[model samples]
Target: MSNNAIIFISVALILSALSFAMDRQKTIAGFKRGWQMFSRMLLPFLNILIIVSVVLYLISPDDIQHYLGAGSGLLGFAIAAVVGSITLIPAFISYPIAAGLLQQGASYAVVGTFMTTLMMVGVVTLPLEIKYLGRQAAVIRNVLNFFAAIAIGLLIGVIL
Candidate 1:
């Protein structure tokens, strides 16, 4: 294991032991509430994770790597944004798949757009958003977010 991993584990163990000794039954009810809440969220989250992981494993890593390179420039960013807008998958589903793609060589900018639209643009949810806040509002928000994602990817390119 890496030195960082070892240090993190050692520190966590020491801290956990100290806390347990000092506060045995303290916050026990709070812990139960937190755990119940977490379990409720976690079960669905894990189900999605497993599904995404399986789908990601089926895809060729080369395809993901192809998009990640800087060869495409603004065109690549645009492509990324467009693809992102189309796929309305959950963030939990998309993130791990994007991460796996990155590991295979996808461009950070492209993956950034995928990640951005995973949360930002919502063509899938557009009807719902529009129902709640009119078509004009929905379109305006999505347009703003699409451009914002592109701007953000460019900014990161410059800074990083």
Candidate 2:
């Protein structure tokens, strides 16, 4: 593992130990709650994983390259942005998928835009966001994020 990952794990372990020492019962309760949440999410997580794996397997690298590579340009960016906004995969899985796409010859801009929109836009959760934050605020946030994701993708392409 990378040094940063090791450090993060170490810090998390230390914090967990400290929390346990400070309040054993509370810590146990927290663990139970966390486990329950994880259990609830497990099926959805696995389903997404399976779907992504199947899609990637079915679509050849050459096809991915043809559609999302450097040559695809603005059209590819738009398609990736829309796809990212609709998809709801967790970041832990999304990153690996993005990396895989990059390795398969997808453009940096396409992958970057996909990652940005996937995290920022959240079309799938718009209703929940609107309910909590109001329609105007949620719509504004998503609109701005979509533009920002495109800008970020372009910048990444320029830089890298």
For all candidates in order, the CA lDDT equals 0.77, 0.93
lDDT of 1: 0.77
Taking the tens digit of each residue's C-alpha lDDT, what string does model 1 give over 17-50?
A: 7776888676465568879988887877787778
lDDT per residue as tens, model 2, 1-160: 9999999999999999999999999999999999999999889778877887788889999999999999998998999999999988888779878977888889999999999999999899999999999999999999999999999999999998
The CA lDDT at 105 in model 2 is: 84
- Reference-based TM-score, model 2: 0.84
Candidate that would win on lDDT:
2
TM-score of each: 0.69, 0.84
Candidate 2 lDDT at 159 equals: 96
